[model samples]
Target: MNAIMVMELKKHVQDRGLLFWMLILPIIFTVLFIAMFTANTDDATRQQVILSIVPGYVVMFVFFIMISMVSAFIKDRDKGMTTRVASTPISPYFYLLGKWIPFMCIVIIQVIVLFLFGRLVYDVPLGQPIILLILSIFLTFTVTGVGLALAVIVRTENMGIAITQIVALGGAMLSGLWVPLEMMPDFMQAISRFLPQYWAHQAFQDAMAGNIVFTELMQTLLILFGIGIAGFVIAILRYPFFLKRAVH
Candidate 1:
């Protein structure tokens, strides 16, 4: 498992497309939207807009990691890597963990990098660093768990890519990442409550404003955990079928 994870990490680091999607494109979106929205606002409103947009974009782009996750799994299966691994003495659980952990680590680093960029470049206030760190960790879990499930479920890389975009972009819109919940219709605001993205973005905003309440924070963390665990359960259950369909 450790060897698999290390090799995967090396591949991910060398993948320029992953770097661009995880880091570069997000920063570009953050800057572009920040400029567009803050252009006509006063200093106070501009700061408010920056506060909202920074975390919004962060949460949205983090889901893009799913694209890479899906691609990796599909490529491995097609190249007979899954068959080779299965023929080894390694446990399937270890194999799954080996594949999953690298993506999770990448997400954790991605979150830290994007947040630091916001802090250093945009001067976006990040209140309560400890709380923010905890939130980021769980957010990584939630996203990657779902990615794992998708990776095993999708038959083709393009299918996974299409679904990932729908989940990431559609979830962002419904979750108020692209706009505040208050600005949306009543039905949309109510529906946002069901999305992991909504809890994540809301908790992040509260943390940034230094408005952390213990109960609310726990609730958000638990919700994210529950969703992630569900995803993992699904992936584990479906993994046998995934292996059976492997090209080798």
Candidate 2:
């Protein structure tokens, strides 16, 4: 598993496209939105805009990692790499873990780097350091777990890409990442409660505010953890079918 993880990490590092999507694009979106919306705003409003937009884009782009995960799995299947691994003595669980952990690590690093950029460049307040760290960890798990499930389920890379965009962008709109929930219709606000993105963005905003509402934060964490676990369970259950479709 460690060897697979190391090998995957090396490949991921060398992929400029992946890095661009993971890091550069999010920063671009953050800057663009901040510039567009914060113009002529006062300091308090500007700070609120920064707080919301930084975390909003972060949550949205993090889901784009699913595109890479789906491509990797499908490519391995088509190239017979998955078949070769299946023939080896390695357990399927370990194989999945090997594939998963690298992406998880990448996500952790991605979150840290983007947040640091927000702090240093945009003067975004990182309320409580410890809580922020914990939130990032859980957010990583939630995104990657869903990615793993989607990776195994999608038959084609393009199909995976399409679905990922829908999930990422659609969820962002509905969850109020692109706009505040207060501005949305009542129905839309109620629906936002069902999305992991909504909970995550809300929790992040709370942490950034430095108020630290324990009950609300705990509820958000539980929801994120549950979603992640559910995704992993689906991946494990569907993996056998995915393996069966691998080219020889």
Candidate 3:
């Protein structure tokens, strides 16, 4: 497992495509979107918009990890790497730990980079540092879980591409990342609640606002944990079948 994780982490560092999605794309979008929205607004309004959208954008783009996750799994299978791993005596749990942990580490770095960018570039008032850190960690767990689940569930590169579009694009739109939830219709708002992105975004927004009520924090934390746990459970249940298919 340690070997598998080290291998994945090294690959992640060298993958220019992964860097583009994880860092470059998010940075470009953040600057463009923040500039576009802050235009013509008063100082207070601009600050408010910056606070809202910058973190929302962070939440939005971190999900692009899903594409990389699916691709990694499929690439390994197609290249016979999965077969090699399966032939070893490693437990499936250790194998998955190797995969999931590296991504979580990647996400933590991604979140910090984006947060620092927002702080220096946009003057985003990160009200509570501890809350932000907690939110980042929990959100990464949720996202990594979803990514791992998709990796096992999607069978081919083509399908992974299609589903990545649906998940990365669709999740952002439905989760109120594209626009504030209050501006949407009541029904759309209701639907947004069901998305993990929505909950994570809400937690981020709350943390930014310093709205750190105990019950509210607990509720948001619970939802994030629940989503992550559910995703991991699905992945674990399906992993055996995935291995069999890959080996065959």
Candidate 4:
């Protein structure tokens, strides 16, 4: 399992296109948002805006990992790698865990980098470091689980990538990543409750302000993992059908 996880991480590291989308572009986007959030000269509002939005970028970019995962599954199926993997003695659970855990770690690292970048470049602070860390862990699991399920759901690489964009962008918009929930219509804000992004963003906001409450944090964790559990169940339910098709 460790070997498989390392190989998957190495594969990601070697893919320049994946690197561009997953790493480079996110950092650039964060930098751009830093400028926009800094436009207001008022110190308090500036910090609040930075705290509110920087975490959104972290969650948004982590969402793009779904595309890479879906692409990997499709490409492997096309190239006969999935067939070979299926024939191996390893259990499907181990194989999926090997893939999923690495991406979770990757997203954690990415989120940390983004937060540190915010701190260094913009003097932004996350008042409770542990709270942010906990949120990152839950958020990573939620996103990685979705990525795994998506890998088997799409029939084609193009479809996978297209869906990734729609979900990532649409979820962010609806969940108040691009705009504050208070600024949106009542109906739109109500809709945000269904998205894991909204909870993750709220958790991060609480962490940033050192306002962490155990009940709220636990609630956020539960909602995030609930989404993850649903995704994993869906992936398992469909894996046999997808594997049969891939091997043939």
Top-lDDT candidate index:
1
Count clashing residue pairs per candidate: 0, 0, 0, 0
Q: Estimate each model's TM-score.
A: 0.98, 0.98, 0.97, 0.95
Kindly report which residue stretches of model 1 are placed more than 4 angstroms away from their true locations once superposed: none
- lDDT tens readout by residue for model 3, 1-248: 89999999999989999889899999999999888998998999888788878888888888888888888888888888888998899988899889989999989899999999999998787787898899899899988898888899988977877877787678888888888888989988998988878887887878877886778777878888888888899989989989998889
Candidate that beats the other on TM-score, 1 or 3, i.e. the better one: 1
Worst lDDT 10-window in candidate 3: 160-169
lDDT of each: 0.93, 0.92, 0.87, 0.85
lDDT of 4 by residue, 71-186 (tens): 88888788987788888887777877887887887788878888888788777778999888988988988998988999988999899989989889999999999888899999
| Best-to-worst ranking by TM-score | 1, 2, 3, 4
User: Model 4: runs farther than 4 Å from truth?
Assistant: none
> Between the candidate structures 3 and 4, which one is better when assessed by TM-score?
3
Candidates' RMSD to native:
0.9, 0.9, 1.1, 1.4
In TM-score terms, candidate 1 sits at 0.98
Q: Model 1: clashing residue pairs?
A: none
Worst 10 residues of 2 by lDDT: 239-248
Superposed model 2: Cα runs more than 4 Å off? none
lDDT of 3 at 120: 94
lDDT per residue, candidate 2, 75-131, as tens digits? Answer: 999999999988889888888899999999989889999999999999888878889
Residue 100 in model 3: lDDT: 88
Query: Candidate 1 lDDT (Cα, whole model)?
Result: 0.93
